[model samples]
Structure formats: structure tokens, C-alpha cells
Target chain A: MTKQRAGLYTALTLLAVLFLIPMIWGVSSAFKARSDIFEYPPRLFPAEPTLENFRAILDGQPFWSWLLVSTLVALVSTAVAVFLCCLAGFGFAKYQFRFKNALFDVLISSLAVPFAVIIVPLFILLAVTGTLNVWFALIVPWVAPAFGIFMMRQYVEQSVPDELLHAARIDGAGEFRIFLSVVLPLLRPAVGALAVWNFLNSYNSFLWPLIVVSDPDQYTLPLGLQALFGAEGRQYDLVLAGSVLAAIPSLIVFFVLRKQLLDGLTAGAVK
Target chain B: MSTVSAQPSWWRRNEVRLAPYLFIGPFYVLYALFMIIPIGAGVYLSFTDWAGLGAPQWIGLENYRYLLQDNSFWTSLGNTVFYMSFTMLVVLPASLLLASALNARGLKLRDTFRIIFFVPVVISPIVVALVFGLIFDGQFGLMNALLQAVFGFGGIEWTTDPLWARVVVVVLVLWRWTGYLTIFFLAGLQNVPRELYEAAALDGAGAVRSFLSVTLPALRPVTAFIGVTVLVSTAQIFEEPFLLTQGGPGESTLSIAMFIYRAAFQRQELGYAAAAGVLMFAAVFTIGRIALRLFQVGRNA
Candidate 1:
């Protein structure tokens, strides 16, 4: 490589390390005692690694319930959202109907509206529907993502050809079956992308869950971790243990679906 | 081959039309129940004073009037603006540079670097809060330890000091978002044709000049997209401050979203919070539009 290109690579290496430092130090500090975390010279590794912090978080609090709630909510919500977006995307892409543009336009506009603006009213709405403290509050709102619909439409329209649908129809296959057997199979990548995206989003969501659910036992992992932080503010090891545990699923999902997720982000992500 | 059984003409026609509606209907229904109705309900509720328990007493814009005069509302708004401006300014350019570096010809081990950077985007803010909360430890934090060891500096009260509390939050936002934005820029960078760079290279244009004349203009739209996202997300920021300080150090780190949440949930000021939410929607909408326009103008220039 040329001199300038070599310099650029070195700089990029430094930035990458700078980015990774927190997680590395987090793992290092997670096993350290509260006092040791405040060591005058920060050590790269814990002096005496212990599982006590993890034990306390897992055993002491309603941590298992939180993890279960988080897992259930993320998966169910993502599935619902992806399936709904697929139906809408297929309809919008395959058929041209009355008020289609207007309806889709409204959904798209709602996407631009800030979630913070709707939180207060949505909380009340969920309460009125008697779904406030239940899993419905988590699953329902996520089931209709405008971005997912848009992406699916783009994917279906571009990839699902006219001849294929026509051929399916000529075989006397029902519209739903044609979509089920043919269209959906073609939309696998977008499905994966939306699944991963929605899962991460639903998993990380804090404000809505924090406001809607008052029950402690139903708290998600994030809320659980926050509760840990709140209860044990100075207990860095314990809090970090909860955090490290909470981070694993998302990290793994991201590593696996990074390509699909990132490509989906760039596709049909116009403002 | 005889599978094309005769159906009634009207039924067939209706099916053709209604099938699309049937497929897409649930989405519209959900959007209405979740988004449109709640938005309308929020606007209506903004005009009344109600806790979750009581019937809403109808008043005319009083909640908004109170929000306008609310000192905490103003403080939260100010802090959000401060955080948004600082992080967006720093992250956008830095991400662009990093994207450019990764996009550079003959770059090796770039995939590893990309993953390292992008990991933060997927990690929850609460986890980010946990990790950084330890780092910002007042006595023996990695930050302070480094300060003491390298420069013989004493510990700084990062979370407790109001100014430093804001600083910590800004740094956290920067760390979490910069890599996320970098990927967008990288995607943008990949779209630029190599021939443009080659053509410029032959015209006696240096790398720096070629980048400004070629790469910068090409990535303008991605920059705008990132900018608007930053504006919208930062305006709604809650977890960072809520986790790090619980809007403490005299509420210096409180974002507008945090303020709205505390109002609605903690204080039972539902109407006030809804009105504040309306204001936030308007603020984000208007500012985002103006910023997009500015970006447009910059691109055209």
C-alpha cells in the first residue's frame, strides 16, 4: 500500500479500538468488586474474577421473569410486525386498488410522527382497551411498521414478477395461497431483515414499556437492568452483570443478521 | 387445464378489488388504532386536564399554556437541543470520515473494523448507560483513573456536576450513534462510481480535492437522512439521562422525552404531558424540515 493509504488504515484501527474499549472494559469490570471497580489505575482484567454479581442479579431480583418477558415480547412482536407488513406490502405491490395510495400515504406520514408525541395518548388508549399491563400493549403497536411495509413493497414489486403470479392464478390457486407459497418465499431476505430489526427495536424499547406497565414482574430486560441500576446504583459489578447478560441476544442477532439488516436499512429508507 | 371454473362475474370483479383491501386492511386498521386515533385523542386530551383516574375536565389550551410557562419543560428542551447539536455535529462528519477511510482503495481488515463500530448501534442504551456509568465513576472511574495516572489530575465529579453530567450524556450519545451513522455513510460511499474518482485523478485533482468535488456531493443525501434521524431520536432521548442521572444534578441531563415521561407517569399530569408531546411533535417536525431544506441548499450549492 502507498504511504497515505497505510496511514488511513492505522487511523481506522485506532477508532475501532476506541469503539470496542467500553464493552471490553465492561467485561473486565463486571467481575470486579464495587471497591475494585474504582481502582486508581484501571486494570484490563479483574484481579479476582467472581460470579457473585451474576448470582445476585439472577437470583436476587425477578431477573428470569424479565428475560422471559423480553424474549416473548421481542419475538411475538417482530413476528406480528413482519407478517402484517408482508401482507400489506404484497397487496400494495401486487394489486392497485382504490384509496391505496391515500391509505399508504397516511401510514407513511404517521411514521414521521415522533413516538414521544404519541406515548401519552397511546398509553391511555391501551388502558382503555384493557391491554395496558398485558403483552398486547407490546405486540399491537409494532405489528404495523410503515418502513417494513415500504421495504416489503419494494422487495415484492421488484422481485415477485407478473408471470409468476399469473402462472399461479392460471393454476386456480387462491390469492392467499399464491402469496403464501410464492410471494413469501421470495421475500425471505426482507423477512429476515424486518425480523432482526423489529426484534432489536422491541427489545430495546424502554419509554413505552416503562409508562404502560406498572407491574414489576412483567418488566423487560432493559427495565430489569434499570431496576438493578436504580436499586444498586453504586454496585457496578452487579449492574454490569445484568447489562452483559441483557446485551448477549442482541449482539448475537446483530452479528448473524448484520448484512440483511444493514442492506434493508439502505433500501426504501428515504425520508 | 380445466381448473378455471366459472365464478359469477360480479364476484370475480369484487374479489379482484377486495383482495387487495383484505390483504392491506389490517395494517391500516392497526395504524388507525395505534397512530391516527391516538394522535387525534392526544390532541383532544391536550385541551383537557385529566389524570389516569378521573374523567377529563375540558379546558381550552390551558395545558399548553402551563407547559409554556413550565421551567422544567424549558430546561429539558434546552438540554435536548444542546445534546442534539453537539452529537449530530460531531458524529456526522466523523462517521463520514470513517466511512471514507473504510471505503478507501486497498483497505484491509475493514470488515472487522466495521463490526467493532456497528456493535454499539445494536446494544441497548440502558446497557450503554451501565457500561458508561461505571466509566464515569467519580472516584475510581476509568476516565478519572486515566486522568490521574496520565496527567496527575484529581477525580472529576462527572455525574454530580451539572455541566459534566451533560458532557457525559453527550459523550454517551456520540459513542453509541457515531458507528451507526458510519454504516449509512459507508452504504452511500459504496454507491459512488469508481470512474468518477479515476476521471478526477487524471485531471490533476489530489485525493482531498477529488473527495470534496466528487465524494462529498455524492453522499449529501445520506448526510441529510442521518441528520434528520439524529434530530428525531435525540429529541426523544430518555434512557441515557434516566439511567445515568435519573435527570439529576438538578435535572440538568433531562431530555424533553424524559420530562414528558416523568410528568405523565410520576406526576399524573397526563394532559400537560400530552400537550408537551404535541409541542415536541411540532418542534421535531418543523426543525427537521428546516434542516432538510438547509441540507438541500448545501447539496445544490
Candidate 2:
């Protein structure tokens, strides 16, 4: 490589390393012994790595239960959200209905409503519906987020051809049948991307679940991990361990779907 | 033809007539119930004195009046504005440059760098704050240790000093979002035709000159979207600062969201909290709309 090209690559590599250090440090500290965690000239790797913190969290705390709750919530929310988005998106993309634009406008505008503005009244509504501490409450509000619907509409417009739908209709295929068999199959990549995105969003959600689920058994991993930090012992080691563990599932989801996710967002929105 | 006359028009048929509405109804129904109704009730609650129970006593504009004199509320809003602007300024430019670098010709391992940077976006903000909290610790933080080891400088109190605390929060916010903005710009960068750059190059424009004349103009819409999104979400950024400093040693980092949460839950001032939320919502919405309009005008110019 020429000198200029070599210098550019080196600069880029250094910046990338800067980005990677926090994650590396977080993971390294998670394994260090409680005393070693705060040592001077903070080491990148533990002097003598140990799993005692992880063991303590798993043995005594309800870590597994929280993980289960978080996983269930993430999976259920993603499945329902993607399905609902596809239906709404396809409807908007293909169908000429009364007040379609007006209704869609309202939905789009509501996306701007600040979360704090809604949280109080939503809390009241949830209490009235006896939805607090229930999975139904945990999963319902996020199931058809307006952004997801908008994303799906963009995807449908880009990939799903109008002529195909017309031909399906002429073939005596019902709308639902055409959608399920023809349009949906074509949208598989987009759906996969949205599913992964929604899963991570749901998994990282803290404020809504923090308010809705009062039961210790219902705590999501983020909330549960925060509780570990709040406990009187103030176990930074345990909290760090829990944080890294919580991130593992998301990283796995991210690695598997990164390309699809980026391509999905790019296909319609920007590019 | 006889069958067609006997059959109702496609739009009038039962299944065909209802399919579109059915497909779209679930989303609107849930949205109205969960989002619209709650927002309406919040607006109403802002006008009354309700503490999560009993009949709400109507007291028009009283909460707003009290809020006018409330120093804490003002301070939190001030802190948020500062934090938001800091990250927006730093992160946006950094994202633009990084996206450009990643898009440069003959750049190897671009995808790996993209993934590395994007990790921060996926990681929980709370976790990011916690990690950085340790990094900024006065005594044994990685940052402090590095400074002393390399420059022989004394460690500064990152969490206690109000200025340093705000800086820490800004750094954390940038770490959590710079990659996100990078992805947005990356997508925007891809949409720009290479021919534009080539045309400008042929006109005796250097790389920087062409980038300015060609690249930045194409990214206006993307920047507008990012701006409004940041505005809306900045109002709700509770987790990061709440974890990092719990609003700090002197309430230096307290955001309006934290204030509202504490008001409703801790102080049972639901009406007051709702009022604050409604006010902030209106302000942010107007500002966001104006920002988008300005971006459009800039593009047209």
C-alpha cells in the first residue's frame, strides 16, 4: 500500500480499537475478583480470572427467572409486532380505503408523543384494566409500534409489486391468502430484520416494564440487574457480571441478523 | 357478465370490503386505546389535581404557575439542553467523518469496523453508563489511570464536580449513540451517486471540496430525521443519567423525565408531573417541526 493509504487504514483501525475498548473492559472487569475490579492502573484483563461473581448471582438470586421473563417478553413482542406491522403495512401499501391517509397520519403523529406524557395515564389505564403484573400488559402496547408499521410499508412498496397482487386477486385468491402466500414470502428478509430489531428493543426496555411489573418474578433482565445494583451489598462485580450476561443474547441476535437489519433499513428508508 | 352483474362490486363485497379495514384495524384500535386515550387523559390530568385516586379537583393552570417558580425544574431543563446540544454537535460530525472513512475506496475491514462501532447502539444505555461510571472514577478509573500514567496529570473528580459530571453524561450519550448516527449517515452516504463526486472532481475540486459541494447536500433529509428523533427521545432519556449519577451530587444531571418519574411515584404529584410532561411535549414537538422546516429550506437554497 502507498504511504497515504497505509496511514488512513491505521487511523481507522485506531478509532475502531477505541470503540471496542469499553466492551472489552466491561467484559474483563466482570470476571475479575471483587478486590481486583478496582485496582489502580485498571487492567484490561483480570490477574486471576474467576467466575465467583457469576456463580453468586446464579446461585442465590432469581437471575434465571428474570432471564426467562425477558426472553419471553422479547420473543412474544417481536412476533406479534412483526405480524401486525406486515398487515398494516400491506394494507396501506395496496388497499384504497376510506380515511386511510388521515388515519395513517394520526398514527404517524402519535409517534411523536413523548413517553413521559403517556406513561402516567397509561399507568392508570393499565391499573384499571388489571394489566399490571401481567404478560398481556408487558407485550401489548409494543406489538404494533408505528415506526415498525412505517418500516414495513416502506419495505412493501420497495419489494412487493402491485401487478402481482392484482394477478393474485384475478386468480380468485382472497386478500389474506394472497398476502400470506405471495407478499409475505417476498417480505421474509424484511420481516427477519424487523423481528431482530424489535427483539433487542423489547429486551432493553426498562421504563415501561419497571412501571408495569411490580412482581419480582416478572422483572425483566434490565430491571432485575438494576435491582442487583440497588441491593445494600452494592455488588458492582455481580452487576457487571449480570450486565455482560444480559448483553450475550442480544449480541447473538445482532450477529445473526446484522446484514439483514442494515439492508432492511437501507432498502427503503435511505438508499 | 351476468355473474358480474349478480355479484356486488369488488369494493362492496363482504370479504373484499372488510379485508383492508380488518388488516389495519388491529393497529389503530390498539394505538387509540393505548396511546391516544392515555395522551388525552394526560392532557386532562395536567389541568387538575389528581394524586392517582379519587375525583380530580379542577384547578386550571395551577401546576403551570407553580412550575414557573420551580428552580429545580428549570435547572433540569437547562442541564438537558446542554447535554443534548453537546452530543448532537460532537456525535453528528464524528458520524459524518466515520461514515465517509468507512465508505472510502480500498478501505479494508470496513464491515468489521462498522460492527464494532454499532455494538454501542445495541448495548443497553444503562450498561454503557455503568461502565463509563467506573471509567471516570476519581481514584482508579481507566481514564484517570491512563491520564496519570501517560501525562503525569492528577485525576479529576468526574462524578462530583458538576461540570465534570455533565461531561461524563455527554460522553456516555455519545458512546451510546454515535454509532447509531453513523449507521444512519452510512445509509445516507450510500444513496449519494458516485457520478456526482466524479463530476465535481473533473471540475478541479479536491476531495474535501467535492464532499462539501456534493455530499453534505444529499444528507439533509437524513440529518433532519436524526434531529427530530434525538429531540423526541432526549425528553425520555431516563436510564443513563438515572444510573450514572442518580441526577448527581447536586442535581446537576437531573432531566425532566427523572423529575417527572420522581414526582409521580415518589411524591404522588401525578397532576404536576403530567403538567410538566404536557408542557415539554408541546415545546419539543414545535421545536422539532421547526427544525425539519429549516432543514428543508436549507436544502432548497
Candidate 3:
């Protein structure tokens, strides 16, 4: 038994190291001078590390602007998406109105519709309507994601009791008031999970933003990094620095909410 | 007082029946506008030729016919299928193994391992691609350097060779997604009744037998959910190949999504791109529906 346990830990430790190498290497490379990035017998830690890459990218490019736009888009979209999803999920979970199953089926089936299918027409639709503003285009269309609704529905069903809703209704509480005061508080963990998920999605989104946001001045982090990488020669130093910085917020958010995110994500699937 | 007491007002009386509709209304409204209408427009655009300018010229079946003969379209479709199969076969099973290991009773620092494994997914795909591109570069890459030191064989052509390029993409997919899927499986494993395993042990069933009979059956729902999710998402893979190889060394790793992006944005073949998109939608939607039925997902709900 001891031998088996030892084997397990060894294997787990090895796998963990394998998982961490790329990020560690990338972070290390970000600090390395441009000349030492591809040094022979590639060292895991930078020898003569400097702040030049980070300083150069920050000073020369609109790094913070890209970060701001990405953060704002992710934050706003997450907030709106969480509210709409929770409301819809509550409706689906607690109610048995007409066409409920059919409505749910429609919503769930929409998940299968590839984004590639909508890329062309959605772009044109936004263009034709003259509502192609970055904020509107990014946030409004995606604020009611089906996955969020599904996750919220599963959580509501599991955690919130039908009797509680009846009690609230009996106490002369309006439906919206009940949801706001009662249901919303109950959905805190799932909300954290969904918010992080939505934020990462919006923040990391590349293709949609790449197609829609043409103006360089309005580029998101991914677009700005892509531009830097694809410029005259690959701006590896700037991009690596930008990549490291771009990853910090997401990593911090994930670490802070790691428990809720993991548990909340699996709540729907486990049953 | 009379007005306040009059049948408790019409709004109060009907709120129960109408509240659900109101609650779910916003989602359906946005869904129809963004999802249904755009799909309708995509279908319409598929039948016409447009270049982001004036009214589209109706060219019935021409794009589809052209796509039928387009080698790049076929190659992209083939590569996408390869990617999808790899995820199902390689990544899914690997995750299950990882989850099983993580689920072991009294395992130390399980949470730490889980978090570390999941870090790749939290990072942006572009960052992932750049890091991977540097590590796997054919010349002077960390991977090659390590290979040379370990096995004395280093010239693997990670990016330049067609087969190696596809392998690199799959490796990236595995690294990025295995942990994400593992958490779901771990959750499923945790939920499995401990009594079932005890009963299996009492029946003289060994670890493998108990796992087959108890754990596998218990994990069906999660596996189904993950299966369908992975299928649909992998069907539309883009970033890895696009960023790493640019579908190069002769379009060997070009995904259908990349093909569409190139055709529509780079080549200005919007109609052709839409046609390709329609085909992908049909395939994915059909497969997803079939998988949903096969798994009986959401049936209990």
C-alpha cells in the first residue's frame, strides 16, 4: 500500500510539473533579454533578466487601453449574462408554464449552432443596423448565453427549494422581488462560476473581435498582441511581455474563485 | 382602500401565470435576434454572392458546387474530423485517467494539482499559441533542445512537417482541455455512492471490476455532457493551428473554421465562406442532436 501510494504521488507530481512548464517557461522568457530568449541549452530561469520588454510594450503601445477595453467588455458582459441567465434559469427551474419544455429545448439546441455559421451575417447585421459600436456589438448580443442559463438552471434546481418560492409568494412578495431578494442570493456560488467563465470567454475571444474591431485604436488585448506578433517582423519580445501581463488578471480571478468555479461547473454535469 | 382590495388587482392575480414568461423573455428575445435571425441570414447569404458591398447577387447552388470540388475545403473538413477524433479518443480518456487518479481517497494536495492542471485553460488561447509556438519551433526550440539531451534525436520538425504540425495542435488541445474535463469526471466520481463499491468488494469484485460496474455507470451523465460539449467545440477549432502553423506546410492542419475565416476575411469569398459555414452547422447540429438523443441528456430534468 505504501509503495502504491508513493507511486501515485510521484506520478501526480510529474504530471503537475509537465502542466506547469509552459507557463513557467513563458513567464521566464518574458523577463529575458531579447538576445537571450533563444539561448542554447535553454535555461528554465532567466540569467540576465530585465524589465525592458514590459517597459517597452507599455510605453510604446496602448497596452492599458487594450486591457481596459477587454476588462470592461468582460465585466459588463458577465454581469448582464449572469442576471439574464439566472432569471431565465429560475423561470425554467421553478415554473411549469405552457411550452416550457419546448422553449427549453429550443434554447438548448441553439448551443449546437456553431459561431462560424453566424459570423458573416451577424457582422453584416450589426453593420447594416449601424450599431457596430464595440460596447454594443460585444456585450449586447452575447449577454444571454445558453450555457450560463443551463448551468444556472441546474444550480437552481439543486439548491433552491420550491417550498421557499411558495412561502415567498404567500408573503405577498412580487415575483421579481422574490427573485431579487431570495433567489439571487441563493445563486451566489453558481454566479461566481458563471461570471468567471463568461469573463474568460469574452476576454480571450479572438475571432469575433478580430473580425469586428478593425480600428487599431480600439483593439482588445488579443488583437493588439496579434498585431504586434504579425507586424513587419514578429515582435516576440513585446508579445511575450504583453502575454504575461494579459494573463495576470485571469489567473488572479481564477485563483480567487477556484473552488466555486470548479464545483459550480460540475454541479450540472454530476447529476 | 376599495381600489387596493378590488380582486387584489389584475396584476397580482395574473402575475403567477405571466411572471415566468417575463423572466425568460429577455433571453428568448436576444436568442431570436442574434441566433435565429443570423442563422436565417447565413442561409440566405450562402445562396448569394456578396463581397461586403451592395446587394448580394443570387447565385443558386454555385458556391456549394464549387465547395464540392474545392480541395482546401475538403482538406479543412478532413483535418477538423481528425482533431475531433483526437479529442474524443485521446483527450477524453486521458482526462478520465487523471480524474480517477485525483479521486483517490486521501490523496494529498489534490486541489493544488487540479488548479495547476487547469491553469492552461485559464490563460488566453493566443498566449497559449505563442508560448507553444516558441517551445515547439523546429530550430532552437526548448522541446527540441530537451529531446536532443534526453534521446539524442532532436530534428523533429514540429512546425514545418505536416504530420508533426497536426500532432502539435492535438497536443495543445490535450494540454489545454484535459484538466477542464478532469474536474467534471472528478465531480462525477465523488458523487458515486461509496456503498456501491463496498458491495462490489463484498461480492469479490476487484478494483477493475468495481470500476467497470460501478464507476463507469455512475459517470454516464457527465461523460455524455462532456462528450457532446467537446464534440461541438472541437468541430469548430481554430486558434491553435491558425496561430501556430497558419495551416501551413501545405494546408495540412487547416481547420474548417480557419478555412472559413480565410475565405471570408482574407480572400473576400464571403459567399463561399458562408456556404462552408452552413455545411459545418448542419453537420455539427445533426451530430449534436444525435448524441443528445443517444445519451438521453436532460431526460431526468
Task: Write candidate 1's Cα lDDT for A1-271 as tens digits.
Answer: 7888778878888888888999999887778877777777778898888888889888887878988999999999998888888988999889988887677656545545788888899989888877776688888777888778877886787688999999998887778888899899998888888899899999998877887677888889888777767773456677788888888999899989988887777654332
Model 2 per-residue lDDT tens digits across residues A1-271: 8998888889888988888888999999999999999998788989999999899888978999989999999999899999999998899878888898677766666556778778888888788777764588889887998777877887888799889988988888888999899999999999988998899899888888877887887788988888888888668898898889889899999999998886675554462
Give the number of the best model, judged by TM-score: 3
TM agreement with the true structure for every prediction: 0.93, 0.95, 0.98
- For model 1, residues B1-301, the per-residue Cα lDDT tens digits are 3678776578555766688888988887887788888888989889999987869989998898888898999999999888877867787788888888888776788777877888887988888888898788887688888888789995899999999998898888788887878878888888889999999999999989999999888877777767777777787888889987889899899989999889898899898888999999887877766775666511213
Question: On residues B1-301, what C-alpha lDDT tens digit does candidate 3 reach at each position?
Answer: 3665556788898998999999999999998899889888888989999998888999999999999999999999999999999999999999999999999999989999999988899999999999999899888789999999999999789999999999999999999999999999999999998999999999999999999999999999999999999999999999889988899889999999999999999988888898999999999999998887788776573
What docking grade does candidate 1 earn? medium
Interface DockQ of each model: 0.57, 0.57, 0.83
Runs in model 1 with CA error above 4 Å? B1-5, B8-11, B287-301
Q: Report interface Cα RMSD per prediction.
A: 3.2, 2.7, 0.8
Let me know the DockQ for model 2.
0.57
What level of docking quality does candidate 3 show? Answer: high
Model 2 misplaced regions, further than 4 Å: B1-18, B291-301
Q: Rank candidates by TM-score, best first.
A: 3, 2, 1
Give the Å shift of residue A241 in candidate 2: 1.3
Candidates ranked, most accurate by DockQ first:
3, 1, 2
Q: Among these predicted structures, which one has the highest DockQ?
A: 3
Candidate with more favorable, higher DockQ: 1 or 2: 1
